[model samples]
Target: MVETSKVVVFQVGNEEYAIPIRFVISIEKVEGITPIPHLPDYMNGIFKVRGELIPVIDFERVLYQRPSNINELTKIIVIHTNELSLGVIVKDAKEIIDIPPEKIKQLGLIAYGKTSYFTGVANLDSRIITLIDPLKMVQSLDGIKQIQDFMAAEVNT
Candidate 1:
């Protein structure tokens, strides 16, 4: 039997990106993000979902070094890993697509310098989507340790 990864595709700027569906909690409408102080520019703030506080980050800023322009189509892709839970702001949540292992190409060494989180690219003939490992992306962020500790404490209290 062959294994195909199901991923959630989302828009950031003009490109489409994908994350493994297993990590996604939900697709939320952009709302009620309470800005906090002293966070990295990429860290938008924190928000509550079912009483759980999850730190939010801007996908565009993390990728392009510019904040995302929020509009009606904007959304938050809530995902969680063993380390922490987060809400990533995206221009739009596109669709879920299945990517076969054969269709995914690993990133080259040169591309790894900055986008270490980019696991591969899915070639679908007409278009390609960059595949991201959410855990790696979140871990690579500056000040993530403090954010993880804060989230852990929030969960405990």
Candidate 2:
């Protein structure tokens, strides 16, 4: 049997990106940005959804090291990893694409440096879609520990 995977394509800034659909729980309109003091710039803030406070990350800022423009198309993607659940704001979501295992390509070292967030590349219609590794991207956050600690404190308080 062959294994197939799906990617959730989205836009950030002028570039297109995708993440494994398994990591994404849902996508919704951006909302409830409550800024926290002394937090890293990339950490947008926290938002309450379904009775849980989820941290919102500026995807553009994290990858491109610049602030993301907020427009009507801006949306929040809810992603859940084994240890954490958070939201990432993107310029827009394109569509989910099904990629056969054979269609996926391991990106070369040169391309990996330019797109560190991506785990590999998926080729479709002569166009390449970067597959972002959500764990790697989230681990790159400088203040993730702080956010975790803050959440713990909030629970205890």
Candidate 3:
């Protein structure tokens, strides 16, 4: 018996990215995101989910340092982790795919500098999808402390 990890494949511009399906809450249409003062451009802002407000982030901006194009194909993936819960805008929300341990490659030391957001790379058929750790991505930002403070101080008030 082999253990398999379920993952969701999504697009940021032309690049395909993946996250463990267990971290995903839902796939939703891009909604109105309320902008916050002093927030990073990649932070996008916050949106209401049920009664809770989740900060949204631009996947393209965070990973590629470019703004994500919001069009008909774009969607927001609501992801939750122990440290952060937020929506990530992706160009297209592709289907969920299973990644077996054998197909996933661990990142080497050379891949460490700028690829901190990605935990590993998944080879899914003909294409390779970089697996992003959304929580880590948020945690690594320069304004993360402020975002955390905002989330704690204002978001609930």
Which candidate should be chosen as best, given TM-score against the real structure? 1
Candidate 1 Cα outliers beyond 4 Å, as residue runs:
110-113
Tell me the TM-score of model 3: 0.92
Task: Report the number of clashing residue pairs per model.
Answer: 0, 0, 0
Q: Which ranges of candidate 3 are over 4 A from the true structure?
A: 109-111
Write model 3 residue lDDT over 1-157, tens digit each, in one string: 8898888999887888898898899998888889887888789899888778888889889778999889898999998988778898899998898888999897783257566878888886899988877767767777777777888886667
Compose the digit string of candidate 2's lDDT tens values, residues 1-157. Answer: 7788888999988877888999999998887789988888988888887888888889999878998888889999999986588899999988998889888888775255545666777888867777888877777678789988887776677
The full ranking of all candidates by TM-score, starting with the best, is 1, 3, 2
All candidates in order of lDDT, best leading: 1, 3, 2
* lDDT assessment of candidate 2: 0.83
Superposition error at 20 for model 2 (Å): 1.3
* Candidate 2 Cα misplacement greater than 4 A, ranges: 110-117
lDDT of each: 0.91, 0.83, 0.84
* TM-score per candidate, chains pooled: 0.94, 0.90, 0.92
Native-to-model Cα distance after best TM-score fit, residue 79 in candidate 2, in Å: 0.3
